[model samples]
Target chain A: MKGLKIIVLAKQVPDTRNVGKDAMKADGTVNRAALPAIFNPEDLNALEQALRIKDNYPGTTVTLLTMGPGRAAEIVREGMYRGADKGYLLTDRAFAGSDTLATSYAISCAIKKINFDLIIAGRQAIDGDTAQVGPQVAEKLGLPQVTYAEHVDKIVKNKITIQRRLERGIETVTAPLPCLITVNATAPECRPRNAKHLMKFKHAKTVTELQSAVEDYYKLHEDRPYLRIPELSVLDVEADTNWLGLAGSPTKVKAIENVVFAAKDAKQLTADQKDLDWLMGELVANHTLG
Target chain B: MNNIFVFCEIDEGKIADVSQELLTKGRSLANELKCNLEAIVIGSKLEGIESEIAPYGADTIFVADDKRLEFYLTLPFTTIIVDLFKKQQPQIALFGATSVGRDLGPRVSSALKSGLTADCTSLVIGNHEDKKEGKVYENLLYQIRPAFGGNIIATIINPDCRPQMATVREGVMKKEIINKNHKSKVVAIDVNKVVTDVDFAVEIIERHMEPRKIDIKKSQVIVSGGYGVGSRENFKLLYELAHVLGGEVGASRAAVDAGYVDHARQVGQTGVTVRPKLYIACGISGQVQHTAGMEESAMIISINTDPTAPITKIADYNITGDVSEVVPRLIEAYRKHSK
Candidate 1:
């Protein structure tokens, strides 16, 4: 079997599992600086699936692609430590404030410049929770897509079988190659970073970071191509300016409110049958259930 | 020319409840926008399905019935929907945020270059004032959903995009009844005009509907187990209690991660969000991830050894004891009282 060329779309999102009072600003925008940024939880799961394919097929290569600010390049380095071969950072001032549509447009533009057999991404980003970009990219690229993927069962002669985790059950289906898949968190947890790969790719930096670095690493990057993270701006990717950033985004935030749930005068119940019977009776009377 | 369109999902030759809920909401939204409320049904042999939608106030029902469109292959279904959207320009489109809808809605929205808000808890027809750009868009759908892991609610609006779209959460909105005598105009389109053989890129090998399908989100009552349940054997008690209560079994992420249960039963940020009428948390230490899914229940009851478990804080009724002991007694009481 020919080695598969896989591309994993990863994102650096705010750790939403932990939110504080300052997590949201007065204007309802995320207080990104206050919250620590980490690789999107499910994106790690996507990387694991890609890495597994590379492990099973000896010569397969895994590439990481992420679109965010300059700091988002950290995820690229992180992916490298976890067995990705190379990474691309799509960063530009014009890409700010883009919603799912424009975001996918920009990402698709970058993807068009690359060659790959399969594209994989997390089912949804924790920050937006839209689960649109992966499929949207597939549509733009005119490729078939499978979402809610839990496992890749097998690949033979350009057909890939996937087991999807749905809300109610599992569905195992097969799609032809050159397809896109958005993985679910139910997939296997990503393997930890390799010590040797970490030491090798630790100094990998995007052009924006290398420009501001005080230490001279240009010679080192020239010697080792893997230490250089490719950076693409809107111009480099040939994206339309009108479809780049806030202008390209159609969704607008109307308002935001902080909701705090507090129950008043909750009834206390013992573990005995008397209280259970009363509780069940109250539920029946209120038509909560029969 | 602009109308409100709701994608009426079909399950086992019947319209799904979530579709009716969207129709109910779509009716009011159409009234607000002074346009017609239409429904799109794509399936095989979808006769008599129009009645289920018309009563909910759909002005027109468009059906694209074909044998190939029966089980929802992504390519064919997406092609049909996208072709319809292009021909019929809608001001706003609504979809039930179920498995089929979630998979198809994005593909359609992207093909049309439209914006879609997913898993919206509430939706309203309103105006959007862009404070940053000093622009105002009148008659837009305000899509509201929980953000930051249910910590806050954000209202999203697609101002610049046409055919503003949203997928509503299941069981979030109330389905209402209108005049039963009213009938919607039924239009049947030829599927061959749009869908071609090339759409069938994905082949189905084996499709299996779960034998004991546990639908926690739609269940009226849910009995959820947590890590404190200890072992796989202990989860049997939860299933027994849930059986007596006529409720489905759910599990927290901890129990699922610990290999005590399958992912389908998980209730948390990463799992299914449920709003059952009665939610009984058994031996579950309520992490924010778990509570985010079930806290919306009408009544929350927690039974745990640790009284200070986070779930107890929000629970309407708190019981301090071992679940193994309390659950059996509760089951016995329910069995006796009902008999």
Candidate 2:
């Protein structure tokens, strides 16, 4: 089997699953410490799909790529812990506050520089339920896209067969190679972290450590030194400078108003003819019984 | 100044109510922007459908009827809309953010290279209304969409693009009453614009009849249970209560995660967002994500054991106690009072 390069798109979102009523900050932003760090559920599902493809086909290497703060490297190690061959974190202060459009541009640029056959991503991040990044990435690449995919039925050579989840039912779709797939939660659950993988990549670090490792490796083994996934500099990718973040983003935040819920109190009216008739009138007026 | 197009969705030969809702909304947008609102219907034998849409206030109906369109295919739908968009050049477009809309909106918008916002709860056309830098165009229409999962709202403008598009979720707007006597113009377009390919690798084998037909969006009242409901077995009581209330049953994300219900009934960030007249939350702690869907409920009732549960703070009537006790009592109260 040929060595197949696979890239999985990962994102760092605030741990919204654990956010309580008071967990939100005064500014409407989530308090980071109050929220725990865990892989986005769908992204984990995406990695699960990637690992399945890797396991089914020999000589396949899975690479995790993400653009976020240095803390997002934790997701890369998470990928490693889940059996990915390598992980790459694309972090720069300049790439902040990006909407889907700008975010897709950055990802597509990074994808063009990598050698890969498939790009698997969670259908959408929990924090931003837009479900746009995968499809937008596909548009940027000009490839056929399958969103809300439940499972991969078969991968016969270059053609991949999948079950695309529909609203009431599911449809089986087969697309040619080099296509992007956004895995919904239907994929098998990602495996628990393997202890051996944790020990192997426990030394993974920030770009600084990664760069320093390259120099150390160069001095230690002149010909065959260990090479981690390289940190891509801005110049290495074709991301349009104007479209990098907020500037390319045509959307501007108008406001953030926290929503509060208050329940209504209404005693049930008895089934007497007059009372029932009046209640019926109210329900009909309110369109609750209509 | 121009025409705004809306995709009129139809199901089982009847124009889906959301189309009328879109027309009601599109009417306002067209009125605000000083343009004609055009309703586009694409399906077989939909001749008099325009009659139904007229009272809602569509100035024109672009009808493209064909057998191929009877059942939706992504390719044909996208191709037809793309062709129509190229020719009509509407200033804006709208689609219902349904399962069908979610499936079609992105493909159509991408094919046209036009901007599209999905699942918007609100629509506010910028006051810039009629800004034309040149006779060709200026003062572009800015479409505002909630971003970062509703953490903040963002205003989006497509200066160089034609026909700004948005897929609004159902229940965000109300449908206008259909009046057969209402007036509108009809323009029939060629249906054979694209070569129809009947061969699709995927086949729909069978559809198991869903035991319960619950369209959460269409349900007027929703009885939702949460983690405080205790266990999956308790959900039967929630179902009983909902049945007695003559409403559909729903669940918080917590209950769904606990394996109490299907994803369809789960309401929240990852679940369905619903706006009902009477939203009864049983044993559910109100989280922002969970509240996003039901906050718009005309009336909310929280029955939970925890007095300080988040649901209690926002509840109009908070019955602080175990749902196990309160729910049965509420059911009895409803039955007793009604009897």
Candidate 3:
């Protein structure tokens, strides 16, 4: 009924959707440069839900809060182009190699510095696939969280109704405002970038980006405050140095192996009935089926 | 003593297969560590749960059966699990990467300040060698999972954390019944001790389970479509083929995200991993994201217009033709053959 402050937690992940020969390095670490970085797929779904809320309730603002390297600022701009009112990029050298726990810590710290009535995020990031950061962030903020959210059905008074997609069925639950909801991939796809919004926010740059730009865009940023996308470092959020990055991250990578499926066990067959019958018979014989 | 723990999930009064799979894996891990394997079963009226998991290799079963826990509510479940973990202090904990586990695992791990790796495809005990980080942890749980959409398999380790936690996807590990006569020691905990009024924050207004839901993961045969399926309307052909075979229909992440099918039917790294007896892939190019989920199937039949499609390489039978035509013929042939 009243105005709302919505924050969509997003991430810029290496397009894990598309993998090439150089996708992984010899050491098994992802070759970030080989794959183009794009906004996390589900986060875009979360953004759509947030955008819908903004549409229903005018004066509501949707801000994207993404925590990654300096390159992650791109997702913030991407979010703005798709109608996010503003964005914040949480990046710093100390925040490198953060697992879900540490990542949530940083995001929660930044959230504390912002005004928000609803916190929305993707069920999980494609790169990590942990799906923990959203819930972990909610826990850190001491807020109720609804995971596997398919839709925000309605908001009556301070209570919000959500439809959750589960393996067996759908459940409709209600949580009070100031809660967290992680949108599933089943949610609506984000609206395409508005041409007007794209043109308006295309020039928006973070302080780190503005300083390194080839063009003299500092003067333009001064003239238009909205053109400036705030870059918040660890210190900006006043996060504890000890709980910022690898030090706070309890999970460590032991090794990475590039797995290629071998065709050694496969037997090619024809599409004819005889081959199909033989295959079916063989499966039954082997106890794979009956 | 350090022990291995499993969170046995119950759905519709039956122990989930994934939990049994974890118990099978946990039994061996506990043996290697020279410790006991215990399971936590939380539900109401769980009279036979102990006997149910007895053959799965757990030596102990902790049950928290209360009316409030009859259906899973996040806060209460997390509270009890956290309390039990703190009291028991198991060395490692495993959960099924399902809706209940995904919702509860993170909350418990975060509350306990422990690290949890989710949806692991493989679990092993090995030394963690991080040469770049100049650190090596001996005898750690090697939580192996496909990262970056199944592009690479990363072995995650919680070297310094207690109760190193991980959630494994269903069908990734085979559940072996060790002893049918085995009896697990049952220990019931009082729910009132750990639960509080504040834990009931989110209220469940309604729960609806769609009748005859297509559970592709458990289907004996799965007919999956991909980008080659063309459009949402064309997916009906997959349904027809699957129907004739008495199987369920599945879709690649591309197809699901394209609105061809529901996310529940998605089979990929981002979706469900299915080890069906027979997997018929139509129009799917067989990206690792798609293949990794169905790689363990007994047999793979890929139908694609492109002969050189990567899926063809791993497919036992690669039918190089248009799926729209091939599927119809196959459906008709199967119908006639059955009749």
Model 3 chain B poorest ten-residue lDDT run: B330-339
Best by TM-score: 1
* lDDT tens readout by residue for model 3, A1-290: 98699999998888776788887666454567777899999999999999999999889999999998788889999999999999999889888767888888899999999999999999998887889998899888988899999999999898999999998789999998889999999999999999999999989999888889999998888898999989898889999978767778898776776545434655665556666565555543333332
Interface RMSD of 3: 9.0
Q: Between prediction 1 and prediction 2, which has the larger TM-score?
A: 1
Candidate 3 wrongly placed segments (more than 4 Å): A25-28, A262-290, B129-136, B211-339
Can you write out model 2's per-residue Cα lDDT over B239-319, one digit (the tens) per residue? 887766657789988899899888789988888888876788988899999999888876677776667777766666666
Q: What pairs collide in candidate 3?
A: none
lDDT of 1 by residue, B18-70 (tens): 89988988998788788999999999988888889999999999999998778
Per-prediction DockQ: 0.37, 0.15, 0.33
TM-score of each candidate structure, all chains considered together? 0.79, 0.70, 0.78
**Ten contiguous residues minimizing lDDT sum, candidate 2 chain B:** B199-208
In candidate 1, list every pair of residues with a backbone clash.
Answer: none
Task: Please write out the lDDT profile of model 1 over residues A7-88, one tens digit for every residue.
Answer: 9999999888788889887656677777889999899999999999998888899999999888899999999999999999
- Runs in model 2 deviating more than 4 A are A1-4, A18-37, A209-227, A261-290, B10-14, B42-52, B63-76, B108-114, B128-162, B188-212, B215-299, B302-315, B318-339
Worst 10 residues of 2 chain A by lDDT: A218-227
Model 2 sits at a Cα RMSD from the real structure of 9.6
The better-scoring model by TM-score among 2 and 3 is 3
Report the C-alpha lDDT of model 3 over B195-272, residue by residue, as the tens digit: 998888799999998654657776767999998899888999998877656578999999888888899999989999
